[model samples]
Target chain A: MVTVHSTSPHFKANARRALGDEQLQRALTNVPGGFIAKRQHAKDKLPEFDALRDEARDLKNHTLAHLDVYLEEYEARVIASGGHVHWCETPDEACRTVIDICKAHDARTVTKGKSMVTEEIHLNAAMQAAGIQPVETDLGEYIIQLRGETPSHIIAPAVHLNKDQIEADFRATHTHLPADRQLEEGAQLVNEARQILRQKYIDADVGITGANFLVAETGTSIIVTNEGNGDLTQSLPKAHIVMATIEKIVPTLEDASTILRLLGRNGTGQEFTSYTTFSTGPRRADDPDGPDEYHVVILDNGRTGMIGSDFQDMLRCIRCGACLNHCPVYQAVGGHAYGWVYPGPMGSVLTPSLIGVDQAGHLPNASTFCGRCEEVCPMRIPLPKMMRHWREREFERHLSPVTVRYGIGAWAFMAKRPKLYRLATGIAARLLKLWAGKTGRLEALAGAGGWTRHRDLPAPQGPTFMAQWKRRRP
Target chain B: MSAREAIFARLRHQLAAGSSEQDRRETASARIAGHAANLIPARAQIDHGAQVKLFIDQAEAVQATVKTLASHDDVPDEVTAYLRKHNLPQAIRHGTDAQLSGLDWHGRAPSLTVSHGPADPHDEASLSHAVAGVAETGTLILTSGPDNPTTLNFLPENHIVVVRAADITGTYEDVWQTIRATYGERQMPRTVNMITGPSRTGDIEQRIELGAHGPRRLHIIIIEN
Candidate 1:
């Protein structure tokens, strides 16, 4: 597990490094055109996309409001259906419970689907530490796992890695495989991975997957995937464990359907994913093949504190990765720059809070407050507001640098009175333009080195827009 | 503790904590109403035959074959003809409706088996139905039942869905409303799947390829009134 708390400083340094890396800049240049254009095209085809979003939002809000009741109801139903439900208050507890389950089964190998909660808990490392070989079965996740990196994007984990990099990783990993083999094409790479993962799917002792939505009424967990890996993971293994956040529970399948309509449209441009599996319990008495034991670990992990807070809206997130695609900072630096499991605007707000303000404080400040993330967010989490909240929390905890705090205080004192603010702005604008000259660009600044290193900031042409507007009104 | 006593004690504690049980109940009810208002739209009169035709057209557009049968008795023969048309040597997987228990399949094909259990990936084709078809997005909702196992819809190489004309709805909202009416507030079905088209991905170099994971072919049988 990549701990955001421990890696905040490293992430800030790397993001600064990323700002100077021309190769990373070139790689990210296509993201806005690629994901944004595709999503717009998809939205244009469906006029009811906004209406569907509204429905999904409402459904999620309603479910969360009654989460306690629904969770108990779901627990009863899962028990009745011959499945065990375990409540975990923290990531360590969730991992311990899963490890215990694995120990009980004497599991050696575990095949895993693409699960965000498992990522949150860093279950793979824990399982490996316990002497279990955890294999990622999803194609994209498998690629990232082979490369020894965390998932950058939620939907496309290795979206940052090009075909050449993938080929290099494969060549380095697959030693017995010929180096001169013609694996230039993506299809060939996919087929090669498919052949490799087939044996793991069949031979694994246990399987783990995340729940997209858990139906409270029926006690069933829904796992949607573009690949059929989730099905094989849940079915082939002798024991299956579903690690999910508590907020994933919806009241019924009807409610689940309402959310599903928005999930596909928001995440990818698909009406539905290729595979949407709903497993209630272990295989039935007469059923031919499925896991003999089924367990659902509902993880809280600081989510309970978020339920009634200002950040409660974050719980409505379905992990669609829409905001990540539209986020400018995310596109530039990629997921690794965020230095956590989640890597975009959502991550900036969520990672800091889940970890702590002092440890991951730089994450909240890594944004321009562009509002594009909030615009594209499916659950409509006010990301900028949440980021600002984190900023306030950072300040209160004295997590911000002393120079930045003093500079902000000095600016605030000046701005408190109108005459002083106008006088300061008038002199500053003239001085900046004098330095900028005819090009109307400032290549460097006295104090702001971070802003000038990557790109030139344009100087003000004349009086401030607010000052000009005030003069014209008078 | 007795159930009534436990309930009363919990209610009393909530009331003592500056919240009332009635207030919570009213808020929950209001939230549910608000959700229903946003999710369930005004009912629109549906032309079921036209909706089925729309799904059939979509299926064909995605390069899948379609066949319609008069009754359960005609399914085996139609399936056999389908296999023969495709030049397949052996009968692949066969799926039946929950209402198809009495249907005779003794003479039509030797390899045909009723799809009752979980689907094996080797099955070339599996048959099922759409409980309702959303013409807006050209999607099909398949709720899990005894005959329509969710695995059959995903695990096969080819999917053959049987849709009755009356089950087709115009939009997703309409479909949800219909589902709610059928299942009511209690005892809802385990799974309700909305399948739009064949599985596809543009992940590798942004090139669209069918059958990246699930069935590449999606066949539909729209039985007309």
Candidate 2:
């Protein structure tokens, strides 16, 4: 029902297209400059911020270690609270389960909160195929949905769009409204969206939302949002469905709080989101207004494979998009270049695991390894190290291109004999110095066209670092 | 095998040092029942008076307006004044909480028309009584019941919440402890909303705009006396 043109295999071509996209480049300029200062300010205000991150990491580690037991406990608690849990091994099964639930409710229209898990499974397209309208309530998501595009950024789904592009999209889609309605500013666009989505929320038969955390203690699903769309989507509908991965479950409220401290500060630089709603189950007997039925669809979709593997640490990701915010590679090319639901350093490590290494080989190779993504990650996920692991896998599987393999092979062949390696590098450095003349940089180079296409490669000043180190020390 | 059983089996199989099923269950049960508090921020460990001040400061820091009154009797007049000052409609909506119902809105603001129950699209303002306020981040914890219907929290242009000074605590952990005592062990209200500020979104090129789908303005009334 859903189409995924994974350009991850064509990462080079995708990156080139992204570089040429002026609008995307304009949108991407906001990331490195915008998020860094805000995160720093939030971190600086709290002295115990780093300590909380450590606690968060430890809690996730502990939870993952006993995932099966914790999940069993969580399922029991959910059932006790009058909610049903549907375990889905794959995306197709998850989609089928959701459709069955919708059919059971006789739902014509389904409203949704911003959920990356749903995006992972392409829920919107599937719902549409089933003759159900899936209305994205998040302003960002709604905009992207209107454009029929996947999210470029995790938190900000429409981060790649500019105000003008949005204005045009609104004009093109919202034909019922006055075509000349002013939408010059972000405020105007927001107001227009609010007016449009308000009626949809009330008319919706079922509401689907993603949980930031699923509490095993009380069987509560928590969603943190700056806009209250998630609340409106769930509260007004007849049935509420939570689409979450199995890894989202946590032990207690205290643990949830510990992670909350890191999530808000790192993700949006808020002490707390405007609204953090914890929903346990269907509306109670005393409740005046709420959904009558509650259901949770827990999808595995290759996450179980991540457990006990070297990539298991990835399960700790809370989907804050902090790595995307801080990743230089992500900032340069934007998220769409990575060509999947996730993008950036975390995506580089995760895409291979979810889709396959052969498909997402370019993701790991795309990183500069400056280590900013890992430094900024609230869960302390060793992202660069994981990317290296992926690269190793790609090479071991012979997924790397013949040219790259042969280049590495030739280098390795010489490197094993220290004298031969030193001689090769020494000669190359001297030849490059001679070719440089006064400019001291190569504007063009044969066989290294990819490197020279954008910017000049700096000429080597002297022998390689190994030669210099040996001469100085020996 | 069912998806659930198969997934669980795969997980246990992959675990490096898989414990007995009983051991795993006990560990999970102990953690849940214990509800142990981890490292709380030193900032939240403060005296009551300081906690109140910190609450106000934190709330204001997030663009939420704060006003203090001596008692609940002053609430209706304050709400009327806020609506008039902002040049908004004098119409408001609220839930049937005793704390809110006890306020003499008919006597105080006769011109202001107030409705009860869940919110609709046309609502200009709505009010509720918070179960507790967290000082650590200036968050108001509102439990869903007949007292305060969850819909009033959203679907309005302006949202006003009245919080008793005594109910405001130093951290979210304190609020959780209070919830346990109020709702009984392991039972929570249908929904517990922790609201720090009015609705906002930064989805448009990462620039924040207030009142995306909820109240544009959030005014908190702290009863200090």
RMSD to native for every prediction?
4.3, 1.5
Q: What share of the true interface contacts does each candidate keep?
A: 0.18, 0.90
DockQ agreement of candidate 2 with the native complex: 0.86
> lDDT of all predictions, in order shown?
0.73, 0.91
Per-residue C-alpha lDDT of model 2 across residues A1-474, encoded as one tens digit per residue: 223557788898999999999999998888877777888899999999989989999999989988988888788878988999999988888999999999999999999999998998988888999999999999999999999999998898888888999999998988999877788999999999999999999999999999999998888999989999999999999999999998998999999999998898999887788999999989999888999999999999889999988999999999999999888788888999999999999999998999889888899999999999899999999999999999999999999999999999998999799999888888988998889878999998888888899899899998889878978995
* Model 1 Cα lDDT, one tens digit per residue, A1-474: 233335665777878777677755665665666677777766666666777677778777766666666666678778887889887766887899999999898999999999978888888889999998899988778888997888877777877767777778888887888778888888777767765776787788999999998877667898877667787788778888999887888876557766776676677756556556677777676455568899998887777667657787888988888899898789888877888778888888888768877667888898999999899877788999999999998888887999979998998999898798988899999999999999999999989787798689899899987789988994
Q: lDDT: which candidate is best?
A: 2
CAPRI class assigned to model 2? high
Candidate 1 second chain TM: 0.73
TM-score of each: 0.87, 0.98
